[model samples]
Target: MSLRYKSAEESRVVISELMLPSHSNFSGKIHGGYVLSLLDQIAFACASKHSRAYCVTASVDTVDFLNPIEVGELVTMRASINYVGRTSMVVGIRVEAENIQTGIVKHCNSSYFTMVARDDEGKGIEVDGLLLENTTEIKRFLKAVKRIEMKRKRREEFDREDFVPEDYLSDLENYKVKVTCTDEL
Candidate 1:
């Protein structure tokens, strides 16, 4: 493993796999979880290779299941390291399924996964990052940035739900006690 990494634009597919019957659902269609796991595996490889360290999942911005893949079809999921941060790297993954025998293909899903690179002591480390030499991959890195921002803003907003002011009144009658309990919280 090399510590020098290329920019996001230079990230490329690290690995791929053909979907098998064991990876499908009861309906004989590839299961979303199975596909997700495959995406994670590929992304992990891309991140680990670039960062030259252990990479773990921090978050998945989104995954759109655009189509279905039958058990006999060949599902190819390609993952690329699209962006790098102080402690995190973003990987873009696209999945497509093709009828191996018929030679027909369809886009199945696409997503961005955020990964944290950790040293042997479980501390943060810098990644080699992608070179981002092309327009398409540059766009992907930009998109990953945007996706991360959106998810972050959403998390900030959602965190407010974890607390409620005494006067906010979960129930009108229950709003009486204003006692502060600091230790457990």
Candidate 2:
């Protein structure tokens, strides 16, 4: 079959219910981390659609929470492939939570993620060179490109630091990657 979505087109995934609670925080808003996990899942869907290959989240850039999501809101996650490299693909995912009952829509978060599509041997695979379909898609791609550039710059700035982040310093336990040999294939 042909590819799922055009390069310059917006591929959206809607989440009807993501466990919204009536009252959680003092402000009665859903937790930020909960929303972040949902974004990761939707971004995975976008990457898988583009490459038709299993992918893993390599890195998640800055996530700016512009607004809050109340209970009983329908969180619609719109994601699209923005940039492609040798083995890594960057997807732009915008998550908006709307109150279906009150018809209120608000932007929750906008973030970019890097995904690596791998073959059965757990190696990166080659993805098609997709073409943009319109100006809006092109605009999104450009914005993601800029964000990636900034990521590189920020990495360089932190290169000289000896302190390692807590997550990085933690032991790599239970993070085994499944790999299969060609002979077994």
Candidate with best TM-score: 1
Each model's backbone clash number: 10, 1
Which ten residues in a row are the worst by lDDT in model 2? 176-185
Best-fitting candidate, scored by lDDT = 1
Reference-based lDDT, each prediction: 0.78, 0.73
Could you estimate the TM-score for every candidate? 0.78, 0.74
Write model 2 residue lDDT over 82-157, tens digit each, in one string: 8777677787777787788778788888888888899999999876555777787678667768988888887785
lDDT of 1 at 50: 74
Q: List candidate 1 segments past 4 Å from native.
A: 1-5, 8-11, 161-185
Off by over 4 Å in 2: 1-12, 22-27, 157-185
Per-residue CA lDDT of model 1 for 59-85, tens digit only, reads 887789999878777777778787888
Worst 10 residues of 1 by lDDT: 164-173
lDDT for 139 (candidate 1): 88
Alpha-carbon shift of residue 90 in model 1 (angstroms): 0.7
Q: Clashing residue pairs, candidate 2?
A: 8-133
